[model samples]
Target chain A: MPSIKQIARNEAASSRFVSGHSLCRGCGIPVVVRTVLNSIEAPVVVINATGCLEVATTRYPHTTWQVPWLHIAFENAAAAASGVETAYKALVKRGRLPDEPIVFVVFGGDGGTYDIGLQALSGALERGHRFLYVCYDNEAYMNTGIQRSSATPFAANTTTSPAGKQSFGKLQKRKDLTAIVVAHHIPYAAQASISHWQDLSDKVVAATRLASPSFINVLSTCPLGWGLEPNQTVRFARLATETRYWPLYEVIEGHYRITEQPLDPSLPIRAWLEDQVRFKHLFQHEDAEVLARIQREVDRDWNNLKRRSEADAQWFARHSERLAKEWTGSAARPAPAMTSRTNTNP
Target chain B: MPLKAPKIAPSARMRLLTGAEAAAHAMRQINPDVVSVYPITPQTPIIQTFAKFVADGETDTEIINVESEHSAMSAAVGAAQAGARTMTATASQGLALMIEIVYIAASMRLPIVMAVGNRALSGPINIHCDHADSMLARDSGMVQILTENAQEAYDLMVMAPRLAEHPEVMLPVLVSQDGFTITHSAEPVSLLPDEEVRRFVGDYRIPYPLLAGEVVTQGPFAMPDYYFEIKAQQVRAMRAAAQVFDELSEAYQACSGRRYQAVEGYRLDDADRALILMGSSAGTAKEVVDELRAKGEKVGLAQVRLFRPFPAAALREMLTGVGAVAVLDRALSFGGTAPLFAEVAAGLFGQTVSLSSQVYGLGGRELFPEQIAAVFHDLESTEGLEQPRFIGLRG
Candidate 1:
């Protein structure tokens, strides 16, 4: 894992993402974008879906990007990235271009990733394109004025799903996009948050090292949409993870591995929901059931993730013992190659 | 700008090929770096034949089997911006789905080439021939070309990349063949050599490739102040595409014996009456013109090969000697004037040519030579021809 100082030094040497244009003052997206871009060593090309990060960073006649960046539409970032990757492969294969290594990265907001872009994302992953897709999930359609999206949490007050009479804000739970990506059987997929910069950076490094598709659904807090103070962006982000609303874990070659355990596993989910105005209605007496439902859902999901990760550890242990016996039993054969698809996460 | 002539002219070989196979053969010859396509009715055979070429190691193309037409075009845009010679194919509903990215591909100035099997848009779900698909994308900033037969489809596919990649006209080009009529019809097409096509297309290099080390931003969101100027650039590029198409066709004529023009006129020089149309239906009109000329009737046919950039000057020039003209459209504009009729009317605005609009062949309705003869016969006496006429409709 790269330390904060090392990341800062690498970013200083070559700032792939620079500070300019109109991203909000305490936006968590830039940190996620910068860390992911800086963590990868190869030449990187970014394909961005039309959203807050894309619109804000790349206003015409001025751009904050210091690397090759492309934005096609609201729901086709993965498709666009697949194109660029395929082009690179074709050019290199035909000797039209030199065989240089490039990491193609796609950044889409929650609305673009979990909703409209879901089919495109699934297709790209299934095709096994050597790219990294990062969903900077800020929950709702922040760029489109805080409209309700599939990633919006239950009882969240979005413009489309407001907390009015006969309404307890949003009627459903947030979509588990990271798990959806993992179900594609990609080499690596993770649930990361911008609050843990080192874990996010490490996952990016791991994801880019493999020559197959990988994904990371990063929880990036939106200050404007969340109706929280700009300074509380990272605080809210950390609170969510600590409260188990968003857990830090990864799936490597179908094996679940927890990257960070919450400092207080017994922390109530209300601590994370009470401060953000989107969930303000959940605190009201009339919406008490919605808050209880949210807390129960979070606890159930966290426990399920923990059990899966434990099962993965046990499965690896048994597999390793069997491999050891096979290796000892045969003199002419060596241990099998540790390919991404076959290797167990340590 | 003229391309440098090769040392030896390309020798052509005759092959019995359908319009789709001819297009696939052109793609095989050009050997674009990337091809991303989805399967539609008439367009399927084009991609299917190209897939066979790829499977046989006949062409060096990275063909992406995208999930939808939207992704197919989106991928083409990405591949083109990445400095790869890219191509894709689609039809009616597929074109409709891909139109959004098609506009983006043009606005970004990516020289991507697309082959469209012209099919009618569906409410009742018809899968036959019409110009509704390509005409639907008329104002999308792509330079549109319609082919009259398998030979033209093959030839236009070969010539499209050069026109699209011209520095002054870096826009997407749509080479359309009338679905089923041309796409499913087999005809003898003269093909150029593979090496010659490779030399013709040459190498494609964008100033700022996404994979290149240099960083550049593409497809940026422009505010009101910059949006108009950016759109004006697309308009200028599209206007320049008209001259570039002529130059490319001339260059192509040098390699292959076949010559092409934006407006192809058949026996229109000495005629007092003419029929103006586009796509494979022009073939039927041409046959009718020849039969009429055999009887000393002063009737001619003018085919609009290039539909976009309107080619108003060339079209107006084609009708200079003709006193009356019948504009035949294969697609309707619903509650308004037919698309081709509107273009012809706008193109011949200042001229004194009496004009009549004739709509036919919707939902793959067969357009016979006699119906075309009737249209020419209608032009013989240009009286009370104000309302648009629907031909062959049993009302």
Candidate 2:
């Protein structure tokens, strides 16, 4: 069996898109996108939701995309991709497209996936399209200049939800998109961070293999949007996971499994919060009680997730075996019989 | 042996179909891949018909009933970007509500086609024929096409997506039909055969970036470094749509044996005075022009078909040698001149023509043929109408 490093190296070597068409320096979105793209070998069509990713990559007449990329309106990437995927499947069934498994993925920012695009995403997931949706969660509406999104962390400074004398930045906690996706009872759902490149790539690869809808909520970093130095993107992302501020986990067939357990006596949530300008006001105000409340909330959520993971161990083990069997069986089987229908216009 | 091109009726018997029905017929002929629709009259019937078609499995198209006009356009942009021919319809307040995202759709160049039931912008709240809703979207980089009657409304709807998705013209198209005048008014319209339309328009071939399996970046964040150039590209695409419009219209005429010009002229060949108008008001003005000609008066009419590229050169050529032109505008510009009239006057600048503009039919007040005829008579008698006069204003 190949090691994880060997697997990553092979995937990287076969990267479909060329490097550098103009993303901001150290942007985590492109990194996650590239890793995801490299992990899959199928013919991939990407539907990009309106947000930082769409705004950063495509400028008309000149683009950095090396594969079929579409920039649809914000809030409908899932619906749009469902159309594409549906068309592709229908065409394949009719022998219009080649009899090969194709990958249809929708890439959305936090605002597009968790806020405005949520309804469409929910519909697509419920409809059960064989597609993967990747939500690059940078926590705020970063493309529109650090505006507050539903995924924006509690007590964090954003343009619309600013922390002032009367208030702390955002009063609400970050939306649980993973829970939302899992609620749809999709075959697979995972939470990942850009800092863990290998883990992210593995999750994407696993997601594409599922027969039902799969979602990967990636914790992406935005230096400019978050008011941090460019070089600290990866470091901040790592700290987030380490402190259990952004836990890494996966849900499969209604079962939760912790992919990366935070070490005993996890780092204080304050350490992760103080790293960015968004939480600076909380530190300056000496709001110990607010900080304590945030810490307690994180601790409670982490403990709950940990307990669920422990309870679902047997289910996940069985799921892993079934997945392995399916993968091996698919590999052994010949390609599905090609349909005789001709797509060519007479 | 080469297979002969499929033949259909030269012109089917014209039937009076509502503007909504006309739009529905056009959508049925095109058979787009997806129609992301949220119903708002006088635009609801169009989507309703489309939804019925999808449900009946008459057309192999996806019908998504979204939450709002915002979501409708959003879904359209998404579907179109995913390389599917997609469209939606909205009107008046709905259009105004979607103003911001509409601009984004244009800048993104998603090739989305929308039908706007031209209605009044709100203040005291009214829903009737006026160009204010669409006029507010003038700078959104969409190829705005105004239809004068049910026939033009139907023809333009079929022609719009083709022009919008052209490689050189990958911008959205707005097919505006007056809210009540055309949208609700039933008029005889020739529905083109689906095969003929498919032959004329051909399959939508999105150029470089948007096709499936091609990783092309779209709608990227354009900072100070790239925003201006991206805008310039959008402008270039809109300008390029002019030639495509002409090409498509000619092909459409060849296929259906009926023709539509970018600017339709009625009795303007040997006339000294003419009336310029857009949308359904053109139908009224044309009637007025014919009546004046029968009365031994030399008056004609020019109707604007394509509004986005403005058809400035075409208007200038059509209006040349005509001694005077009165532009009847159905929408107000507020604090400035009438929107369509302002564009016309700007086009005719430096040309030897006595020009005047009048704002009428504000908030869906009817502009009858007699009212237009009265305006023409006023223009004939007066040297220059100093300011735009409202014909149907109540004191």
Candidate 3:
């Protein structure tokens, strides 16, 4: 496995996703995109669902992609990727295509993945296609102008669910799509923030190499939508994980592994929310109830994840070899016989 | 490992097969590189039987078991755009769900062939036989063809790839047959030799494939500067298909000894009156025409084999010298005239011949010889046909 720094260096030599697109300067989506794409070593084909990442990257004739890229519709990236992977298998099997181990990756924003694209994502996961589905979760429909998405956190003010006069921001709680994705029982499901480059980079590496389907939800930042200073984006990203609002953990083959357990438990959630104007109303008024509820939801989610992680630790200690075997390589895994054709070149 | 192509039959031989079976057999011979499919009633056999072939090692095609018709076409768009000869099957509600991607497939210029078991769309949800499913797809920019029997279904399936993947005509194609009426009904259909069918279709090649080392973008968002030019490609492709299909049909005729025309004018060459429609119902109309012809009546029948691309030129030429024509449709446009009637009216807008239309066999309503003969009679007795009338409709 290459280090995150090594991945960047190799990409600088020959990058698959070239730089200089139209994503916002402080936006975390491009960071997430570059990191995830840079981690993969082999040739890749990218399928994107419509969002800020997609619309900003390729605005017709001016594409940021150096490899084969496709954007069909807003909600079928995973479904389309399934077709591309299937095409690779068929062509290679028929000896019309050279047998090369190319990887398939899809990038979708929170609106695309957590909302409109959930069905296609679920279907692709259930079918167990060999690909990586990365969701740059910036909490709302940023490309469509900051409308509330299912991934938007509780009490986060959005255009659709505003925080004005009588309303106290969004009334409903955020959906835990990562948990729903883990329910599919795929090989890997992880949650990482853009502030944590190493964790995000490592997850991307593991996801791209896995023989089965893998999903990683990166908590990207949208400065314009979140109403934060461009330079303060990464700072808020780190504060989010520190406050346990965005826990860094991964589930591998049903085992919960907490990758980042903050040593200090006193990082107030306000530190993460105060800088963003989307949450400014919560600070302007003495809304302790809303603040307390946000903290309660964050702590409750973190505790539940911890309970699963602690229990998983003991179980893994007893069966570490079995767990390691599941991850070391796909050799022991029971993969479907995808094709009868073998590499003639090999 | 190179797959040994299936042994050729040398000459066309007749064998009993269902519409679904014939389609699968054609797929087996074509040996497409990829097939993404999901099962729906009336259309399931095409995919399931094809799956059996893949399982039994009769062919090396990769069959993707998708979750829904939408994904099936979505995957097909991906596969075909990536330079694989891809195909799938759907019908009725499945076709409705996939109709969006069907249009996208054509607009993107992905030459995917989809086999549709024509069934009625929802509302009371009865599914037996109708042209409603195929009707919904007529305006989707795909080259649509309907089969009269198992042989036409088999032959069209074999020809779909050739028409769609032609460099001059890169568009998706839909081959349809009525639901249970033709899909489940068995008939003696002749098939060409496997190698011969393969040689006719040739290998699918796209100039700008998503794979093959050359970096290319597909399904790009065209702005005003180039949107019209990009859309004109479909127009150009459709026109090219109108000619390609004709030439391919002639070539197929030489091989099978059965010449097929885009518009099969059965007994209509010198007739004074005609009944025009498509699908298996054409056969029913032909039976009536035969009886009417034996009685010294100057009635004939014209079946639309190539529905999409309309074949207006051939239709105008076929309808020439005829005094009156009655157009029958199995699918109603609702709040308007029946779909086929509208197209036929548009096809012969300025012609002097009197034209009439009637909606028949909706939601799998059967059309008997008497009802069809009534339509021919209505054409003869009536003068200056205006609005469409519903035949055999409940009062």
Per lDDT, the best of the predicted structures is 1
Tell me how far the alpha carbon of residue A215 in candidate 3 is from the true structure, in angstroms, after superposition.
Answer: 0.9
Q: Which candidate do you rate higher for TM-score, 2 or 3?
A: 3
Q: Which tens-of-lDDT digit does each residue in A29-138 have in candidate 1? A: 99899889877767788999999999999888899998899999988999999899999899888787788678888999999999999999998999988888999999
Clashing pairs in 1: none
Tell me the deviation in Å of residue B86 in model 3: 0.7
lDDT of 3 at B94: 93
Pick out the ten consecutive residues of candidate 3 chain B with the lowest summed lDDT. Answer: B1-10
Task: Please list the residue runs of candidate 3 whose C-alpha ends up more than 4 Å from where it truly belongs after superposition.
Answer: A315-346, B1-12
lDDT of 2: 0.78
Residue B332 Cα positional deviation in candidate 1, in Å, after optimal superposition: 1.3
lDDT of 3 by residue, B221-299 (tens): 6677887887887888898889999898899888777667889888877899998899988877777888889899989
Alpha-carbon lDDT, every model: 0.87, 0.78, 0.84
Tens digits of lDDT, candidate 1, B1-395: 12221122334487778999999999999999999999999999999999999999998699999999999999999999998999999999999999899889988999999999999899789999888999878999999999988989999999999999989999999999999888998877889889999898888877788877788999899999798888999999988999988888889999886778998888988899998899988877777887889899999988999998778899888789788998889888879999989988998888888999999999899888878888888887878677799988997
Could you tell me which 10 consecutive residues in candidate 2 chain B have the lowest summed lDDT? B1-10
Is model 2 an incorrect, acceptable, medium or high docking prediction? acceptable
The structural similarity of chain B in model 2 to the true chain B, as TM-score, is 0.94
